[model samples]
Target: MPRSKRVTIADIARLAGVSPGAVSFALNGRPGVSEETRQRILAIADQHEWRPSSTARALVGSRAGVVGFAVNRPARTLGTEAFFTDLIAGVQSSLAQHRIGLQLVVVPDIGEEVDTYRRWRRSNQVDGVLMLDPRVDDPRPALLRSLALPGIVLGGSPSGPDDSATIWLDDAQAAHTVFDYLVGLGHRHIVYLSGPAEFEHVRLRSEVLAGLAERGVTGETIITDYSPTEVATTMRTLLSRQDRPTAIVFDNDVMAIAGLRVSQEMGVAVPTQLSLASFDDSVVTGLMHPSITCLTRDTFGFGEKAAEYLLDVIASEERLPDRTGPRPHLTVRESTAPPPA
Candidate 1:
């Protein structure tokens, strides 16, 4: 047979001297076919190098053996962000176990992300999706529900009536852990450098700073684009302040590293005059001169669990309860200590 030519169930059935229904039953692991007949049909299928076509699977409302994952962020950022890279690797690991394909895409913004989902559903492009970075009044959840699409929210709580399940991290609790650690070190004033305020996780972490006054701790949260240059600039301004914060917490490891460089340039000694920490950690965190303190969690496991949960939702065809993943823990390092007396 010409390699360009396609093989179908009928072709396999004819070659195996069996009916097409028997071929279907054997291929799908149904009980209608005898064991001997099933083995013969399988041998023919293997000989022809036959595989189910995605188009045919979609048309028949069967498993496409694929899922969609979209990120509404700049492509350049994804390249430098270890968090996403680890998460994606974890997702791939779980998907590989079941031999499922992952369709990954990066869109300019949320609007385009929604458009992509709509198109995918209309064309039966995927059996499900994994949603990330939930925003205020996010339209993706309700849209997924309306389209009768199964999905899993990666980091935020689901809004509106959606059959989608959620895998969430306790951002507020993590923030408190950082605060307690810093405050216990006699750092009365702290600064929180965060990502865009629109992100639900960022908002949760920011909100925790509002109540710090009750404990005689002065706190300030500065929102930024999470770029190195921006973080450096913010650090310059903060370091120049008459009453600079004794400790600073960053939403990501990249920003913390940038802030550390700025501190060094300003003749400030880390953990002696200033301290730095990050909400997320990576191998880079440990490689730094002072080995910056940070909150550590299994980002890869997060993605793996997400893939498993979303697959389950698709298979069950029902809404499931939200799942809370492991909370990040503070890993103290050379970057944090008691404020200089």
Candidate 2:
């Protein structure tokens, strides 16, 4: 038997009892088609294994049909961070639905990250870019706006030109929740193992911790690179102090797990001699010997929504309102408890 002909948009339209234009709008995720009709058209296309050809996509004036994601972190550290892994998975899943690709790049610092965006824009390598690790005086947003590039800020407020949108988490509220939880557990002497101070989220968390000083809770902030080695060293230094904290909170799972190891090596029992909590929840937190209490959020869903918003910016000229996703919630586990007597 001969192979069947490839399915076309017209065939999809005919089968769905819609026009070719309606099928185009549905498949492209445009606003013209109703949600029910869009689903039906998508179902038919999926059944037929139909995909838009690169030629067709380009003919519609779509440049490159790819999105860019650049990060300013050590490659090794990024490799161990499950948060980014899950986030990228969500981003790819959403972009795949639109038949778009993701261009991922890792830079050593914010300067290089800015340059990466400039290069992507100059070369037309991506339809838009996703910005992460936003800072107080971030220049990338302005640069992207000056270039008239469509971009989305992943975890910070929209500070760029009107063309960009921001999908941010409520970091301040999350910090408050964690702080209140720790204080309620009788942990008065606390130390926050944090990421670099330049990050906006880090600053916000630090501020929240500082506010505890007024309430008679002694809170100390120690900045680290979120690397296991740095975190271990910081943990050991703080633990060796004459007035060591009864509880320590780490900014990420990698550092939390390392702190746990350092505590064990130094003969400090977790949740007995010292309590530990992590900011970001990951697989290692739950599977470790003493499950870590940490702040958990839908990182995957965050990525998906960010990608969807960026795609919308690419598809239209209207400015969309900035979106805020669900805030991170504290998930209690074995790692956190009342300080030892």
For candidate 1, write residues 135-200 as lDDT tens digits.
Answer: 766788888877777888887444344435788887778888988899988989999999888888
Over the stretch 182-220, how does candidate 2's per-residue lDDT look in tens digits? 899898998998998889888888889999988889988
Clashes of 1: 0
Task: Supply candidate 2's per-residue lDDT for 330.
Answer: 86
Name the top TM-score candidate. Answer: 1
Candidate 2 lDDT for residue 304? 89
Superposition-based RMSD of candidate 1 using all C-alpha atoms, in angstroms = 11.8
Q: Which stretches of candidate 1 lie over 4 Å from their true place?
A: 1-61, 156-163
Worst 10 residues of 2 by lDDT: 155-164
Q: Scored by Cα lDDT, where does model 2 land? A: 0.83
User: Relative to the true structure, how large is the alpha-carbon lDDT of every model?
Assistant: 0.85, 0.83
RMSD of 2: 13.9
